[model samples]
Target: MFIRIDGKQVEVKKWDTVLSAARRAGIQIPSLCYHPALETAGACRVCIVEVFEKGWSERKQVTACEYKVQPDLEVYTRSESVLKTRRTTIDLLMARAPQNAALQALSKNVEYPQTIYPPVADAGDCVLCLLCTRACEQMGCNAISVSGRGDTRKIEPPYGANPDACIGCGACARICPTGCIALTETPATITIWGKVFERLHCVTCGAPMMSIAYRDYAVANRELPEDYYTQCQECKRKEVTARFAGLSMKVHHG
Candidate 1:
């Protein structure tokens, strides 16, 4: 198939998407949701391209990442229609993540002139870019997914807590363009290979215990592991003994 991108003619395969074809011709198309390893979700709508057929009367704005190339397809990556659509998409995304450095840089790259949009609510900094969702489903992690719908959508772990199957690989956090997923080493209570265990003071005995003890407590309490439970040395000692002895003896006798 013959494709014309940015007024340059190039040969393209039938199954090649417009983005890929543009890449072959050394034309740059700015995209956030398009990843080489993931399926095209067409969520961001940022990589819009104008497509025209030899016999068609009107050109169409299509997502370059999702639109397949056809014979005699004329693709314009920077046509007025494409630019206008992309600019609008960028503006919406910027409004969603105004503090995001990557989004700010993307706005500058597209030369999107900002206009007044509605004030963003106190929402978490997720652009719904689908990187986390794609990674979780496609990469065998299945750790996060979009919960809620529309403006309330958020990338949440299973049951709004860290998934039991999560290997803590940080793939979702790495691929996220907006800083929505916050992954940090904050004395996790789980134990696995390559994990360094720290000593959390036992509440009763003033003895050092596994940091994972907090996780054990959460599991026993049927609570999410993300919640913090801490007991200093003396308090942990009393609580542990109270379980075996009477509470009065453990408290008054101690």
Candidate 2:
């Protein structure tokens, strides 16, 4: 099917959203909570766009990341209404996360109305996009989740529960857009989520790689062997290439 975005018709495939279609057509849409590697969490609402349906005379404001494209659907990515809504959203996000680098970069080109609402108390680094929690879940470790309600909500392990599910893979920290989740690494350990795990040093080069807990998880569940995981990635590649070259030599001689 095809949809018109910003007065240009773009072809869309099955289950394609406005955000994806626009990206394919070289249209840039700002989003915070959407990651292709993870499920769509339209919590940010930063990618809102005005939509016109077949019979609807009025444009409906919707999140471009979650709004599936339909035939003859008209989308205005930068219409006056969209710009007003998005600019206000950017300002509100800036208020909530005043130190967020991404929002700072966005503000360089986008005008802000500077809504006078006070910054959320104890807001910290999290914008509550839930990407960290979602990534942890997708990584098969539900070590953390959203807690509390409304203004008190934050991401952490469940109350009274330890972070036993965490493998120290740092997936949450890696996927978080706001740098809310962080992992500290040392020569012999990696610390995160209130836990410090032993490092898995590569047997070949003695280089610290993933945590021992991460190695255990990958070996047991990701169908990798312990011996292979013990080697550094570059060393492993070199070993494999050498073996392949030896086999080729044997074949050539035979």
Candidate 3:
């Protein structure tokens, strides 16, 4: 289907989000909590856009990331109303994490002097986007989640304790938009959620790979080859490329 964004008609496929289509068409719609690898989340309203559907006299505001493309969908990425709403939303986000580096970087978008709302205590860069929690579940760890509600809301492993199910995969920390979750890794150890796990290494190159817990979980679940983690991915890719090149030369000579 074709959706009109900023007066430009862009062809979009099924399951395409308005944000993805706008991005594909070179239209800029800023978003914070949206990741292609993770599920669609409209938690951060930074990508709000004004939509003028057929026969609608006034524009309606919606998040571009979660908004599905529809027939005759007219989207205005920089409309005045949209900007006004975004300005307010950004102000609120800034207040949520007053010293957050990500929100500070986002301040360049609009001319909002400062937030009028009171700042929360000990509120770090965590906008509470829930990407980390969602990612944890996606990794099959399900180790962490948001606890409490309202101003007392916080993300933590059960009872704010170290999680036993976490494999120290660092998926949650890697996907975190605002550096909310902390992950520390060394050559032989990985630490997160107040737990420490031994790092796995490639037997061939002695290169550090993933945590031992992650490898064990994956191997147990998928029944991967015993030597699957013996070599690092780089070494395996090199070996495959060498074999392919040798085969190609053999074919050419034959």
Candidate 4:
């Protein structure tokens, strides 16, 4: 089938969407939610284009990603109608994700003139791009998915608890564009009275030790054998005391 995009003729397969045809013909269309490997949801509506039929019908806006090309169809990707719809769509997206760097950059290029929208509420660094959900499902983790519907929907781990399948690999945190995911690790420190206290794990016992206590008791300090660092807290204490007492007696006798 043949379609005309911006007055240029392009060939397309029977079921090819306008987006795929334009892309194959080297035309650029800005889109965020249309991943080639996934089903097109048309949720973002950023790829809308104007379709013109030869008769008295007015040009209509349709999402290029989901609009299948018909034989002899004429499409104007850069028409005033298409540009207006795209700019408005971008403005709405920016209103929802003002802090999103990608969205901000896109908005600048698209010339979304009006800025009267209210500030996004507690955005949580999520632009709702759906990348996390795609990763979870496609990567076999299924560790995360979008919960709720519409504006209330949010990405959540399984059952809202840390997924039992989570390997702590931090893939979700890394893929997140908004920095919303909070990955937990061992507690590291506490601040009190404007002073920061460091937490120390005993090399031998794997138990939490007070950094101040370890530093103050010199007699309790002794270097363990390289392999002894894995021993428990009680074992480390006994080893240190035994070695220190022996050394004290030898020095006194000498």
State the C-alpha lDDT per candidate.
Answer: 0.71, 0.84, 0.84, 0.67
Pick by lDDT: 1 or 4, better one: 1
Candidate 4 residue-wise lDDT, 185-252, digit = tens: 34554332122345445554456444332233222334434333334467566777978877421111
- Lowest-lDDT window of 10 residues in candidate 1? 188-197
On TM-score, the candidate that comes out on top is: 3
For residues 105-195, what per-residue lDDT tens digits would candidate 3 score against the true structure? 7766766757778987777778888889889888888999889888778789998888988999999899987887889989989999999
Q: Which runs of model 3 end up more than 4 angstroms from their true locations?
A: 245-254
TM-score: model 1 vs. ground truth: 0.70
TM-score between candidate 4 and the true structure: 0.62
lDDT of 2 by residue, 30-72 (tens): 8988999988988988899999999887999999999999899
Ranking by TM-score: 3, 2, 1, 4
* Candidate 2 least-lDDT 10 residues: 245-254
The local lDDT score (0 to 100) that residue 214 gets in candidate 2 is 85
Residue 103 displacement (Å), model 1: 1.6
Q: Using lDDT, give the best candidate's number.
A: 3
Mark the regions of model 1 whose C-alpha exceeds 4 Å error after superposition: 113-115, 185-254
Residue pairs in candidate 2 whose N, alpha carbon or C atoms collide under 3 angstroms:
none
